[model samples]
Target: MTRPLLSLTNVTVAAGRAATAKPVLDGVSLSLAPREIVGVVGASGSGKTVLSKAVVNWLEPPLTMRSGEVLFEGRDIYALRGADMRILRQRISYVGANPMGALDPTLPVGAQIVEKMRAVVPGTSRRTAERRIIELLDAVRIPSARNRFHDYPAQFSGGMMQRALIVDALVTNPVLLVADNVTQPLDVTVAAQVIRLMKELTTTFDTAVLFVSSSLPVAREACSRILVMDEGRIVEEQSTDDLVERPVYPYTRELIRQTPKIWGETVSTSRHDDQREVVLSLRDASQSYKVRKKTGFGGVNLVRAVRNVAFDIRRGDSFAIVGESGCGKSTLMRLLCRLELPSSGQILCAGRDIATLKGRSLLEFRGKLQMVLQDPFGSLPPRTAVGKMLEGPLRTHGWRVEARIRERVLKVMGEVGLPTELYEQLPLGLSAGQRQRINVARALVLEPEILIMDETLSALDQAEQFKLLDLFEKLQKEYDLTYIFISHDLAMVRKACNRVAVMYLGEVFELADNERLFFDPGHPYTKALLSAMPTLEPRRYRPEECLLEGEPPSPLDIPAGCSFRSRCPQAVDKCSRLQPSLTVRERQDFAACHLVLPPTASGGIGGVGTTVP
Candidate 1:
């Protein structure tokens, strides 16, 4: 029998004060073989992250390992020092959940990668180092890798930053790689691309991987063996197929059930009719930005953020824009909220163009539409008390009566399941879920009819996300509100939304009812997105099923013809020469694809008889 490449023997970690400290990882043990991929999964605060850090001997202060041995290649890492320890670290790499924070913001992202690579491999020539950096960048599916190499971290989207981090980790071909929730912040399509890259790297380099994640489905997709942790203990360990098919642990079974199912599930039967009045409409709306190039020295580039987006948002309906990062979902939300005027087209609110509204009228229009940002803590002021935070919006909107404003704030706080006693406390003291609830309450305090949520649920745990979603449904009914959700989770979109629009490279590729879009997608990109949804089924879904080859093209220089042709597996000569117009195949359902046959030809989803608003 061969010895394992790495092993943790009876590890224990504790936090808080010395006398009253508590253990976060209690006597956890695991092993990994060379060329093997192992998954450590648990909810937040379950000690999964602690265990990963401890293995590399990187535990920070307040997290002391009491008694344990982290053996790599039969040598205890804690007992090594000086050059020995440095050599060991060079053979191992770590990538955390927050990709942008892991990078140096002041430097160009590619320069940082080159610096790290040269530091790991001493005396490497600059030419060799630069060549390797671009190779790794392209390997991780970053579009226009050469141009993006000179851009800062802020210039890249969340998903693009994650890909860059993955490239950094693999640039050295380390013996062991530790990835902690690297895909949690990315969209489904981007997550799938990252997972496929990891699979290929592990095989090609014979590298052992430790994948730590809070999502069981995501872990199952990327790992062969999995260890389940709960409240500082390893509760279960089994092969991926066995765990999914016959999970013996109660906690594992619960996690499997909580995983969202994208296919073969019953549709939402919420009593929202399609004949409601139109609350908002976009007529050939587009948005563009002027960006400065890196090498050209004051040269500028025009980037199209949203292009010719047209849709009708019905009153009392849940509408969603589903797409990967940098797909213009956020840009479209900004247009609807009047944060940016459309460059060429019209954004109509209540049958009037919002661009034409002046000072007082624009303020009034903003009062009717509010937005809930992606980061709850970032969006709210940390120094201000929750009560003041919620009240500020009311006061800004002209609720002069102090007593009435306080009463309304408390009411909305209760409506969002936030305890009234915590209103006087600062936001820094509250948990993530509590802060998110406060974000919702602030938006609700203004009594807005249209609420836009931009990736609001992407940062939460499974239980927290489910709780917030339930609250959204309840508030939507009580206030008769219309929701405009911008997200990348197709599973969540299927359950929470009634109508769906699939956007790709700043254009709507397909628009249809939720059931129709999920069951029988029309566009190739939409189909690829649906197929990439993570699941815990016994049989794994291979990446080849959907056949998306590369990342999306850059918005600065979108392809002349179909923007998706570069990645679409079904592309042809005609697809690259002509951009397809939005053709209606069914009532209120449209698709912009040259290859998507008409409904009559393929027995596709029949025309919806009811009108849209």
Candidate 2:
């Protein structure tokens, strides 16, 4: 029995003085058997995340686990002594939902990994620790483990960095590995890839995994047993298959219905394509970040984020690009809108190459292609009125200062569901969802033909995601606008995208219809990515799910082969030796991995040292 790897007996987390701050967790109890994978699901602020943090012996300050006992291998963890507890803590790791919080910019990623590894083994020399580090990196599929081991956090992309942090968490080989909202943000394919990797890692190590997320479908796919929490209380618990088949709780059923799947009405939209032409087109589009040292290690650090990645956005079309955090999804969005110019690529917008435009031309182009960034808070200025925020873009584009701008602001704000009184209120004064409304209103002000949405819905509530998604579709159809939807949430991508492109390590690994990409994936990397999507679809089980543990290669040290070959389940000997170029796989579907197609007749990927000329 192994005495059940871990168990929470009558766990309750309270925030205020004993009877003051309400309880965040209410008598929640769960147990994990050795090597068993369990998932906890709930809405945001449902206390699922709080419960894991409590169990990992990290209640931090002011917050206490109240009366619950956290048992690790039959021993009470909350009652453990300082040094003794640290030892136990070293054996149990928590990979948080927020990756940015875990990484320290001052240190290189490799050193960070090794540093965690060194903690578990006391006199282990740096060299020995480094060796273990290599093995660990190898396990995560981070190519050139030795070279990147010393690279700082800034060197990695969002998903790669997340993977690195996960590797660091697993460095201790803990009996209990708790993952919070691990794959909710990834697109179906990329999310699927990450999910598969996590499952594989947990399986290979025979570690008990506790997955916490707000997605019921995701939890259903990743865990055999599922627990549903609402407002900090466990309302339902059952086997994954049983729950999906017969959910006893109404809220749980509603959650499953809303969870985005490969092809589902995750969000209902009335947008029809007959309303308009191609709004924005990228012909051989590429974007390079002249790195020039991310943290002062200068000389030559330019990153060609999106190299020769091509796609189009038709009028009223939602073209979603899905990838792990750092897979150039945002870069592609920026490049398409000319927010960042391509080193050598043509972005034809309204039949003009906006890449070479400058001065007034560039300024005017900005009005036509507005971007709604991922962080809504980041979108607004401090003490700036939401009304003024909307008017600035209008004013910048030469909108009159009179009643016209005010009228436009008030109207768009209303469309976003904000009150007219909010016109003068600062963005800081509003709630999270309201601030996002401001973001949407501001972007729609210019009524740009092309809207580059970079993770715009990531911070909003599910209800909010649905609202904004509806607003986007309505506007798209009404104004005949185009959208380049960038997100990690695959379900959203599936629901939103007419066409989808999957990016990996700054390259488009696969591009196709959303259904084709998810259902009949041709690229091995694409298949792995789809498999990695944490799905509640119990019927679509694959053994490869257990092999997706490693992170992607560093963009700086990208492998010469297919960018995804390192993690591709179908990777062959030819993968590492040659690069894979994007080509038509089936119908409109395109992929860059050799696992899907053979190397080109030229004997290698077209260009050398660069992705596409």
Model 2 worst lDDT window (10 residues): 604-613
lDDT of each model, Cα atoms only?
A: 0.85, 0.73
**TM-score for each candidate, following the candidate numbering:** 0.94, 0.81
* Model 2 misplaced regions, further than 4 Å: 1-5, 18-20, 60-67, 73-76, 113-128, 185-206, 261-276, 288-304, 323-327, 382-385, 398-406, 419-433, 459-464, 502-528, 538-613
Which whole-number lDDT from 0 to 100 does residue 351 have in model 2?
81
Lowest lDDT 10-residue stretch of candidate 1 = 604-613
Q: Write the per-residue lDDT of candidate 1 for residues 358-411, one digit (tens) a residue.
A: 988988898899888888668888888999999998888788998999999999
Q: How far does residue 73 in candidate 1 sit from its true spot (Å)?
A: 1.6
Model 1 residue runs over 4 Å out of place are: 143-147, 269-272, 293-299, 537-543, 597-613
Best by lDDT: 1
The global Cα lDDT (0 to 1) of model 2 is 0.73
Which digits, one per residue and each the tens of the lDDT, describe model 2 over residues 49-151?
A: 7898887878766677778788888889877897878689677888876666577889787777777677765777888877876787777766566777877
